[model samples]
Target: MDFMDFKNKQTTVVVVGAGFAGAAIAFHLTRLGMERVFVLEREEFPGMHASGKNAAMIRQVVPNKLISDLARGGAAFLRNLPLDWPVETKFEQNGSFFLASKKDSEKIQQDGAYAKQCGTLTEWWPIERITEFIPIIEGSPASGGLWCPTDGVIDIHSLMQGYLKSAAMNGAELKFSNAVKNIVVHHGRVCAVQTESEEIPADIVINAAGAWATELGRLAGSLNVPLTPCSRHLFVTKPLDWIKSKWPIVWDITQEIYFRPESGGLLLCPCDEEVQDPNITKNDPLILNMLAEKISHFYPRLSDLPILRSWSGLRTLTPDRQFLVGWDPCVEGFFWLAGLGGHGVTVSYSVGLLAASLIVEGNKSQSTNQFSPSRFR
Candidate 1:
């Protein structure tokens, strides 16, 4: 298609993933008055990947500045959603506790300060204070914990469905089980995409393919965007009578163990990370062993906690561990919204809004610079 023909195409956009990033992008595009957005998912349904397999907690008091800003922004959005949300999403403000050994207490305090600078409330509590809320918590290894009262659990399924529903209500189309093989470019600019069934033409294309983001970038001839999809596991315990229904998420970073009340039991993790290719992942018994080992070292009383179920998912990341959410420097009309690491759920709201703003305004902001795929180049 010529320039004039493409100009007449009503700014059609083909978003190459239908997970949280793609759904949020489509939702924001529609909210920005862009009606010709189309989202394509390779699975029979959206969120079959990382977006669905996450731990469903939002902890904003993180280590990095830009990432903390995104998390804070996303949390604010979730806390005060508009009335038109199709699903009655629940944002449980059970809060989060970031525990640390005395050796790491100073750093935890710094992290809390950083979160406060980002407008998120955080408090550094003494070991006595932490044990007040969590009577079972041990005091020898843990000097104190950072508390963020706004951090909480969310219904991720309802959240994703809300984005999909809002986008659809605003006239965006979602095509499932459609996979893109290649992107056809004309004169160094995007022209169309070759799917399994047909060639779909579009003036703009978004590469929000999550774990397969790097491969998709290669198909679009974007060779410099470095992305790695890594594996992480989460496990849930059988129902326990002593568990409190609303205990805050407990993350002992020093011990690499996190636990939160779930299903009258507890959801826990060993913070296990493994570099792997993007695919359906099966739970590794080694990870289960690792969780058991960590629990024994940290929470000895809970070492024998019966694990009823376990699962794993991919969290794509860049070398710097920040997100990639801007137009590609090499490929015109090709945008990126990947490498979210494990922050996909916490920063979904801000990341989607940033992508939409960059695309709609067609300008560069600080966020565009911070998350640009060109940084990898």
Candidate 2:
């Protein structure tokens, strides 16, 4: 079909999935004057999966340099969103404390150094200083901690909605409960996508399906990128007056556990990373036991607190655990914005921006080379 004919036939840039990555990509595309962008979400609402179910901590002290850069950019985007965007992206700038005992001090220091190199403000604080912020941690075995004042908690639901609303306002279309079944390629180029109900023609196909990204890529007849979905659980406590809402989110790097104030109580996670299917992962009761044990060994005061609620989500991870962005080397017009892991909420904006840039401007941009999907090839 001719370009005009294709345009008339609903030629669109279909973004599979409606989490932070997909929503933000759609938002940026519309902001850049792309009028026929379509977002496909399997859930009834955007971010109902990993995006909304995460801990929502924005930490720039990622393990990799590229992820650190993305976090920095994404954090800046979140901080400045209120100025230009109509939707309110609620973010609590309560900061993050990464604690480490004598065993993991060197690694903590190395992470702090990397964060510093990435222009993230980090301060090495003695374990005693941790008591000033969180008194319950005083008796913990932590020797020192890296204080990242810029790391904060965000309202995941609000942020996801804001991205969707902004994208919709700019003429991007969103179709929830519309799962992509197959990606139809014509002459080595993506031509259309088949959903459960209908086939939609598309000029470009973006795989932002989060944990289901690997499945989407397979539909396009591409190589299997090593993607795994890991289940992580978060638990909340009943309201406790002693737990101040102003307390910064604290992570015990040595133990792989983190806790922060949430709704007059405490939100805690054991930092468990169990590989699982992309479907709804059930909360592991053993995790609760593990969390309680950790709390008893560390913060003894909250060990007996009643658990209010808990939920689990999958963090999609690549073999290298870094984000996969840019276009596929073998499949023309097929793009990837998956992996992300726990960094999705922290780096969604930057990831989406880079993905959209790669689609509109190709690798001519300076930052595009680092995250290009071709890197895996």
Choose the strongest candidate by lDDT: 1
Q: After superposition, how far is residue 124 of candidate 2 from its true place, in Å?
A: 0.6
What lDDT does candidate 1 reach at residue 181? Answer: 89
lDDT per residue for candidate 2 within 1-377, as digits (tens), equals: 11112223234799999999999899888877788999998888888889989898998887677888889999998888855576676888888888999988888788889888767889899999788768878678889898989889998888888888889988898999999988999888899999899998988899999989888899998757889999999999999988888888899988788999998998999888898887655878998998888888887866788899999999988877878887777787788988889999988888888877766764455244676666667
TM-score of each: 0.95, 0.93
Clashes of each: 0, 0
Off by over 4 Å in 2: 1-11, 363-368
RMSD of every prediction:
2.4, 3.1
- Relative to the unseen true structure, what is the C-alpha lDDT of residue 263 in candidate 1, on a scale of 0 to 100? 90
Candidate 1 lDDT, 224-304, residue by residue in tens: 677888889999999999999889999998888899999999999888888886865667889999998887777776778
lDDT of each: 0.86, 0.84
What is candidate 2's CA lDDT for residue 305? 81
Q: How many Å off is the CA of 89 in candidate 1?
A: 0.5
Residue 90 lDDT in candidate 2: 81
Checking candidate 2 for backbone clashes, the offending pairs are none
